[model samples]
Target chain A: MTAWLLPFLVPFIVMNAILGIVTYVTLLERKFAARMQSRIGPYRVGPHGLLQPIADAIKLMMKEDVVPTAADRPIYNLAPIVFVLPCMFIFATIPFAPGLGVADLNIGILFFLAVSAMEIVGLFMAGWGSNNKYAMLSAMRAVNQVISYDLPFIFSALTPVLLAGSLKLSDIAAAQAGLWFIFYPVIGQLAFIAFIVSTVASENRAPFDILEAESELVAGFRVEYSGMKFALIQLGEYAHVIGASFLGALLFLGAWAGPGPEWLGPVWFLITAMLIFLLVTWVRWSFVRIRVDQILALSWKALLPSTLLLLIATAIVVVWRGVPGV
Target chain B: MTIAAPRHVELDYTGSERLTMNMGPQHPSAHGVFRAILQLEGETVVGVDAVIGYLHRCHEKLAETLTYAQYPSIASKTDYVAAMTSEFAYVRAAEMIGKIEVPKRAQYLRVIAAELQRVASHLLWLGTWCLDMGGALGGGATIFLYCIREREMILDLFESLVGARLLYGFYQVGGVRYDLPAGWVDTCRQTVDVIDTRIDEYQRMLEDNPFFQVRTQGVGVISRELAQEVGIAGPLLRGSGVAFDIRRGEPYSSYEDFEFRVPVETSGDCFGRYKVRMAEFRESLTIVRQALDRLPDGPISSRPGLKSVAQTRIPKGEAYARVEGARGEVGCYLIADGSAKPYRMKWRGASFSNLAILPHIIPGHKVADVVAIMGSVDPVFGEVDR
Candidate 1:
């Protein structure tokens, strides 16, 4: 009876924990961005705005759910749930520590990459169902940009898999015990840089954030969404960012491998993930966004070819050194 | 206010459908209450129709009702970003037409106020232009906040000198309204010095940055011939290698006495205009420092203090006084009828003329370039609509 309930209970706990963390991650970003701009962010709420996210959550929940008269109601209502699910689903495969995860699938990194890419469908659905021109234009850009970057993102992620010689994420982490992939010679550094660039592009942050270019598209695909619908869309976006950060930590930084006892493994893993998240956030706030064409050009002309070369080189190095686990 | 009907134009090209998109009057990067109806072939803009007058407040008609004494304060409303320059043009017109002799001391005071106003206004333009290109939540906000921080110091200087920050009624027909308060010069000197160093910081932040360079460079190209033909003034003109500044050419309000270089860039693009403005920031500071050093002791106004609304009357004559405002050449044409109020007053708002060049240059660029071009143009709606 206890074994039967284990799978169900673990997922239920993880979902609730993610929902709570996603809300607070927003506050963390705001504070981080605020310091960069030399201003105090959210100071008026309960004790340095610790309760600000809670207040915001309550407000969003209590607010009216405004559906546009011209909207396709069913798709509009279903889009947020569809979008948030895949983002949260990616976390299930990301092991926080040894023996600590949801499924730990055999093809863990592949599953993570494939499932993470599914958020675009819900993004397009929200944009199409809104019945607004800005939303439609933004959705078009989103499709173009995300598809272009995914190749580079995948090729770069595969570099580490090539280095570790394993499809399983736990095996990849275990192989990093002797030396992290990021600390490996030439191929590792190049792949990590490529990974970060594609991650930023896929996440739709600045310098590549033409889809939601507020100066151009206002709120972009989510322009017509209001109340809790807007909150869910926002939650999904942060969850995706957090999910990517966790994956970056696992693949390159050696997830749960740190200077401490075994019990402190999860704590160190969280720290590494947060560090990766902050690095991406730093890039987001330090550059102006490029045009859609320019963004596409960067992905296809630059990132794609270089990442493919890097992937080929990684495979060569792995074969030359004798594959790690195999 | 009713929006004007969208203009229909014939497209020369066939195949792809043209999407007519309305940007602004309500858009985030509109800069003010400006609307542009853009006809696009995919992401490239093929044609543009600009709409103004949402901020129109009958400024010309109001000038007919108020006397010269009462009108200077209201003149500040025209280009509220550089209110001192706006007031200077109105009062200078009154002083010119009436042949009222302004003291040397008063002339120097006007120069100081105008130059300082130039610095303050450019800081605002720099901040908002970055905000327009960068988006409110991104790197643009970082620059915006830093620029505003420096601008606030200048506003504080104005507050101490004239008892107001923005829309100062500091200028009168003969000269300035208030003499520099005790220790105000020291404060002014300190402020400009601090701003001088901060300007370098801003340059370092954006000058070599590839992201900023791509957004601004070669985005908006206004040829020297087009700039002259369209009647655009100030940095927009100088940026195209015109080098025609009213301050240097006409030399009003003792601007001839100040030693400063009028920056000119022949690149004829958004980057050129940006370089011109950044250089102007330094030149304006130089003039401020010079004016502060040579400030003479005397009564501020040539005319006696205002005892009544109609006490100071202008003789029946016509004169157009133009000053180098923060945006461009701010000119006021006054036809006095030997009465307290003018028979006719016409304002040549710099932004009004500066904005006319948009439809000429905005075509064939992508949608992102529109905001970048508009930001480089830097039209304050108060001046444009008035």
Candidate 2:
């Protein structure tokens, strides 16, 4: 039994690292915004607000979780669990560090994509189950917007997979030893930009946050959610954001690959992950949000054509590189 | 009031597949207790029936009970955002009916106060509209804070002149309640001058921004013909390239004396309205600057003593006085009825005119366009549903 426990302990350590990273990601987002807007954020909780997320968690748990009387009892009760479960499941597949990720499956990219798509279902359930009109409207928009934008997102993501000649994320990371895709002059850089736009759109970030336009829909889908349920939903969204950055890093920026001793793969992976999260946070605060139709237009007309071209370009590159072997 | 049957307009109305959604009465973003019953054919709006009267405090009915002297206090509720303009229009209506002569100084003071109020109202609208467009991530709350900062300064000037902040009961039947406070003109002039410089910052933040432009440009288009038929006024009308500003066309309260241009936009969309308002902000500051430069020196009140005027009450007559409010043309129709109180006070709130255009323009657009349309129209339910 003791011999069997050693292998299982690895997953536990990796899981704890993910949880700690996500907690600190929230702290980093706040700190970045505060610096951008010229204010100090969350300095009083602990040394540089290291304990802020803990204090928030405690506060959320202590607050009254009021379920509206008119809400659908079963679905409303289940929505937060549904939202949080996918984020947890996603963590199981994402390659955090070399030999550190729980499952380094051959079809890692496909699995990640499949699991990530489940977030829409959770959002739909939460929105519809709230029994609120605004929530239902947001849910409807969310389904349409997410479904429409997914085409370009998936197509753009296909480019790197084609170039690397494998669906495994670890293999893709290893392929980018010399140069990340973003550094590849025009074609690769365009594909990378498309990935960023689609990733941000899919995660329901600003410019694609129609589901939660506070001034327009009055908190939109989450208007009825409160207390611990609301906190969990927010945590789930932050997790999605972190996951998106990871996806971007994996596909375009060359995940976990940095110059150092070969043994320092895991440490570099952690540092790279933190850098990606900060990049996303900076993007969120720096601009005004775009509307739904604009996003749709961008996805359908702009992103679709550009990504298709990039994918074709990558295919040609692969064939060119392979023909010399004969 | 005849109820018209629903129009048989051939729209993209797929009846069976559509989902009917109800928004508001409880929703915070509806802007002061309003509701819209929308029939959506998949995210595209097919039919929309606006239901108001939720915030209907029966202001007209409430006004019947209040005496003419007490009316100034209640008039502020009509358009709460720019309460000073409401006070000016109502008191001017009373004076028109009573056949009293206003002092030159009082008239000038009224113009200054009303113009300042317009700037304040426009500032609030610009801030909130950006928030509505940008959501939380666009630094919306920061714009809200900056707008309120300028508005607070204007309100302080109102307080110095009229002795109250939100509801200034300063306008009397014949003239104003008091003269301008010493050094008040300089403070107001300085505030206006400083605000003129900061207006560019707001434009840079929202106007030239690609995100803001993309979200607004070519969305929520209202044709010129439709605008006229629907009686859309102010920025909404002007956005469609119509030159129909009441201030310019029918100059009220020394407005003829000022040289200013009414900004117009060719595109009748959300972006057009936004551009017109941004230009109008600069125009409003221009008007305030002009008023302060030529501010006359004399009695600010037509009625010298309140007790002396109380002996000779307003005569039996009726009159209508209209003013260019922050939203559009705000009119007050008053009947004296030979008493201290008005017999009937009918208000033509700018929000009422602005809201009438929604039903005409709402069709053939997605549900998301509703917010853009509503924000462009700039209806305050405190006035619209009042």
Candidate 3:
């Protein structure tokens, strides 16, 4: 039991830290967007709105958790937790710094991908359990969109795996020590673009956010959720975004392998990780959401074909270059 | 062996339970507090039933209690987005029934003011429609803010002419209550010139955007025949290839003197309606420029009299008059029993009749198309439920 405790305790600590960062990410997202729009955001709180999230948390905590009498109680109660837990689980394999990861398992990449898929199930539960037609409709869209886009997403992810010759995330990182995959220049460029597109869709962010289009669906699947439960769902979303960004930086941009010795390696990795997250957020704030069919069309008609070609090209490059021993 | 089996069997018309969804009298996109009960199959809308009267302020009943002089102020709230058109139509109706002829100079100023207000109102619709389509971060709001900046200039011109900004009761039974201030015409010309430049820029950013086009085109198609059947009017009617602009047909105020064409589109889809509204703004600009060019010099009001002018009492009769409002033909039916107040006042709100077609239009569209249809119709709830 004590032996098992160490492994369990490591994930608990790592997931919580990621969760805290995600909360601040939400606040920063608003602040960055406000500055872009030429308005001050949440400034009346403690010192440049550092305490705004604290206030929000307290408010959410105190509000009555009203369960709709018409709702499916068991699923309603389970939805937010399910939505949040997979996001938390996704953090385990994200290599934050050198030797700082929670899991260095051989199939760490697959572990993250499979766990993220649970977000669909969780969102479905929220929508179906709410007993609202809007919720149900939104849920159906969420499932359909996620499934449709997931194919290209997973296919594009294969490019880096082929190049690295291992599904283990740390090994993939070490493989990119000589040259980052994005440095594969043009075709490598195509794969990176494909990866970013898929990841954003997978996380359910803007430009592919048709599932929860507020004007069209009225809060979408989260329409019936209130108070802390709603906040938990939001926290899960931000966590997924941050987690995905870190993994993207790891896979394509080279994780934690910066200019320095091993001890100072983790700090540079954290900065790179932050920089990647900022880049993703900038894209989120700058673009309008595309239509559902456009996103689906992009996946099947454009990205899928491009990803297939890139995978084959990367495999050719890997075989031609004579593989290395890490 | 008399007859072969029927080639096609009719779909079973029976009691399959239809899912009913209530889209509110208080829902965000119903354009105010207007309720629509949508009967759906899965996500497809089978039928829609609208229940209005939620915003019914009983304006007609309120008009019965107010005098002709007091009536224009009350009517301002009916289509509150473009109050000038509402006030103008009511006063025109009263003047028509009362047998008072407004001066020619004031008529040009009225045309100028009303045309400017129409542009401002249409610009507002453009902003809201884009915002509805693009949302906050999509750069959708960039166009909205830009439009408001131009509209503010027009509103400033209104302030210069009338003292108030939004609900200006400048139109009187005889002519107008106020005269144009010094340098007002030149200032307006300069403002309109700047607006003309800005409008071109906005078109470059938004009008040609393929995403914007795909979102709008053929989404909410209202056939010309169906539009006539449903009693749809205004830009919505004109979009269906109707050449029935009240300004062209009846030639109210100084509209007959203006050389502007009534903008029309043949498709009658949401995109066609959007294009019509966009062209109408340019036509209004032409009308404004013409009115400025040919604005004659004279008194703003006529002489006061007991029956015709002074006493503000209409002759015992009835009259129906309409002016092409920003939304459509805003007409008023005034019944005068030789009283200070009208015997009966009924407004033919263009916004109201235009909104009635939504139940017929939105049944086959996706939920997103529902927003597009409501936006293209551009119903002001204050008018619809009045």
Taken over the whole model, the C-alpha lDDT of each candidate is 0.89, 0.78, 0.80
In terms of DockQ, the best-performing candidate is: 1
| Cα shift from native, residue A315, model 2 (Å) | 3.1
Candidate 2 lDDT over A164-234, as tens digits, reads 78888888887777778678657578887788788778888776788887755677778888889998888
Each prediction's DockQ? Answer: 0.75, 0.45, 0.36
How do the residues B23-53 of candidate 2 rate in per-residue lDDT, one tens digit apiece?
6776545766778887777666767899988
iRMSD values, candidates in order: 1.0, 2.6, 3.0
Candidate 1, residues A1-326: lDDT per residue as tens digits?
Answer: 69999989999988888888888888888899999988889878799898999999999999998899999999999998898889899998988789888989989999999999999998999999999888888898989999999999999999989988888999999889988889888887898899999999998888788878888888889999989999989888999999999899999998899997998988888889889999998888777778787888889999999999888888888888887644
The reply for model 3, stretches above 4 Å from the true place, is: A1-13, A35-40, A46-48, A256-302, A321-326, B1-16, B135-165, B180-198, B289-298, B303-311
As for lDDT, the candidate ahead, 1 or 2, is 1
Cα deviation of B104 in candidate 2 (Å)? 3.2
TM-score of chain B of each: 0.96, 0.93, 0.92
Error of 3 at A42 (Å): 3.5
Between the candidate structures 1 and 3, which one is better when assessed by DockQ?
A: 1
DockQ of predicted model 2: 0.45
Query: Lowest summed-lDDT stretch of 10 residues in model 1 chain B?
Result: B1-10
Model 1 C-alpha lDDT per residue in residues B88-120, reported as the tens digit of each score: 999989998999988888899888888889998
Model 1 ranges off by over 4 Å: A324-326, B1-16
Winner by TM-score between candidate 2 and candidate 1: 1
Give the range of the ten consecutive residues with the poorest summed lDDT in model 3 chain B.
Answer: B1-10
